[model samples]
Target chain A: MCGIVGLFLKKPELRPQLGAHLQTMLVGMTDRGPDSAGIAVYHRPVEANQCKLTTFHANPDYPWRKLGGQLAEALNAEVDVEIKANHAVITVGAAEGSARAWITRSHPEVRIMGYGQLMEVYKDMGLPADVARRYSLEGMEGSHAIGHTRMATESAVTTEHSHPFTAAPDMCLVHNGSLSNHNNLRKWLRRRGLEFETDNDSEVAARYFAYRLGEGATLAEALEAGLRDLDGFYTFTMGTRDGFAVLRDGIACKPAVLAETDDWVAMASEFRSLANLPGVEKANIWEPEPAVVYTWSLQEAA
Target chain B: MNTIDLSKTPVRELNQRLHDLTPDTNERLWRITNLKGEHALAVGLTVPIEVEIDGHVGYYCAGMNKEAKVVITGHCGVGVAENIMSGEVRVKGNASQAAAASGHGGLVVIEGDASARCGISMKGVDIVVGGSVGHMSAFMGQSGSLVVCGDAGQSLGDSIYEARLYVQGSVESLGSDCIEKEMTPHHLAKLERLLSRAGIEADPRRFRRYGSARRLYSFHVDQAEQY
Candidate 1:
């Protein structure tokens, strides 16, 4: 059992309250999944030539400043790092590929949680409320956010095993159900030169979308492809730089409730996560149908 | 008349209070407010009382009800009236999956659409949906009457038994051993009574009736491929 929640702000004025609203939503799902929790927040974009990397180290007191200095010298570019708990948001004036290569080679212990211009991913093995508090999720601001509380049905309960797995830049996925064909799919993806970070089934789903998108498939098209290829009872809430999407399998045993008001669009595994949102009483709430892809983006909202 | 605010009172306490009520209890009319999609609200009741929930609810809102009439003013989650023996559970808005699963008796009404498995394994309950129902509704239903005013999704009544299904709109597909039967006069009368009981006004003659073909009841060698 797992819980997924996503919020996309249609109105720009509600951007500052995104994390607070999402925090409440994630905490409400604690009963559904208490093993671990993860969140991905998409704030405003960085400079055109810069990319931000959310890096995690097991030791909370890891020398992030020394790593920043070395990264600056190695890349021959200005590097900025901000520490939060055991994670650091590293910004550099280079492409994601070069930065990732340098960090993996020089700082082997540091794990890159996510890399994009606007997104920062944080996850840990703990209760949802505790994880939220550890990262101060309520005070953060973003245009969109995706959260997952996992019960760890098919994998170990570790920070790496937690969800909101990012494969391609500016994209992440949180899944609520297990996949039966992940081992075969993972092998198929590995043959395509896709490097996997964990053996978790949900990670395979995330990378599958990334693989499809890499091959020039649109978000909806990639999801439709998933409907045909991915074999599972999954309710996935995925995030991109511009928006987020919700998809349920054909059987759709995993529940998903979508609510959209004039200000925001929210999707969760159950209505309890959405019950406390502002203007929820007037929101248009319904369950996403089976094998259907529902996407909400600021581009379309404009 | 009694009013219980669920925000201040826990669901377990409220259900216990309702369970303690006798058949002739003076507090027959009850109102619940601040219903923030909580689960198992007003469940396991045996007294003849009326419960009115003022907001959306989570799973199993009024399950195992015997003689109560529970009404939700907003949407409901999965299994709204699961395993109900008697009484009525009504949802004023849309309902999630398995709306009245394994219900043995009484009536369940959804004024809006019902998601997949609307009346799965229903024993004897009557479910009336003012709108459509999702896939595999009434799958393996033993005995009951399911009335849908709108469309029905795929595989309606896969392995149905004595239960009867009536749909006013189109059916995407029918399950194995479940075929469209002629809408007889007796079925029209029963549909009329069910619609009127749920306060929905629909022409009974426009609905189509479906039931089990009874082919799978005895299992013959020639029908092995269908299985």
Candidate 2:
């Protein structure tokens, strides 16, 4: 079981407090998932051409500056890196493909949490409050963010095993329930050359999206296909560069509530997590239908 | 009136104070403040006392209650008043999943909407929802009445036992062994009383009654694959 929360700000004025609001929502669902927590913040893009890669290291004092310098030298472009706790978000002036390949070959000890134009994900093995505090979540600013507090069911409780699994650029997925057929699905994807970091079923889901996106499917199309191909009781909250989406399995045994106002759209495991949101009492609150992919994008408002 | 500031005091102390009270206690009208969506507020009380929660509450806010009148001013998390034995539990705002689940006695009123599985596996209770309820509500309910003023989500009253379901609005779908039954005058009367008791304003004539068809009471060998 896990608790998932996603916030998409409709008003740009609320963007500065995105992390603060999301942190409160994440902490409210602490009872639902008590083991560890994860968050993916859609912060501003450092540069239009820059590829933002957030990486995690076992040691808190990992040589991020040295790694950043080497990466900059390798690409012959400037790299701006910021270290937060055990995670670092590096903005590089290089092609994402070559940079990812270089990191995979050279930095075997470090795990890339996510990579995108405007997204940075941070997750660790601890309580949601502690995790949020360790990252100084409230002070961060973004347009949208998604968080997850996990209660381990299948895999061991490790930092890599935590949620907000990133599979593609500007894409992250957090799951609330288990999949009965992840083993077979994992093998199916692995045969097709999808690399997996952990045995967790959620990783399979993340890779599924990455594989689909790699094959040139939009988020909506991939979600529709996922509804058909993926089997089990699951509620997924996915984050992209500009927006977020929520999906429930056919059975929809897992709990998911969505509340929206003119200023923001919020989704959480329960209403308590959303009750503190601005104008939530006046929001259009409802439960998401089964087998339906509900998406909201920044381009639509524009 | 006895006002307990939950913000200043812990849940254990507040509940301890309630547990120590008796029927003869003069301070029965207690007001709890700063709930901040906390859990298990005023649970397991035997005295017929009144509890007014000034704010939202968390999981199992009134679980396994007995002969207490608890009211929440804001929304509630999962399983509010779950397995209540008697008395009244009311939510001024919305309720999460499984509100009033497995209640044996008394009434539960939600002034706002309730999420999925409201009153699931209820042995006997009277649940009144002022607004809509989510999917799979009243699943496998044994006895009592579930009165929904608004629409019900998918698969309402699935595998229900003897409990009656009265939905004023749309039902997305019906569950196995649960079928829409005729709303008799007796049902209308009972529903009228339940609605009035819960302070819900709804016309009883517009409600649709649903109950068990007893088709799955004795499992059949042919339907084994279906199960």
TM-score of each: 0.97, 0.89
Tens-digit lDDT string for candidate 1 (A162-199): 98999999999999998999999999999999998888
DockQ of each: 0.72, 0.26
* Tens-place lDDT digits, model 2, residues A1-302: 78999999989898889989999999988888889999999987867777989999989999999999999998898898999999998889887777788888889999999997888899998899999999999998988899999888777889999999999888999999998889999999989988888888898998998798789988889999999889998999999877789999977688888888889999998766886788775576666767889999999855
Model 1 misplacement above 4 A:
B219-227
> Over all chains combined, what TM-score does candidate 2 have?
0.89
C-alpha lDDT values of all predictions: 0.93, 0.89
Model 2's CAPRI class is acceptable
lDDT of 2 by residue, B68-87 (tens): 89998877877899999999
Model no. 1, DockQ:
0.72
Among all windows of ten consecutive residues in candidate 2 chain A, which has the lowest summed lDDT?
Answer: A280-289
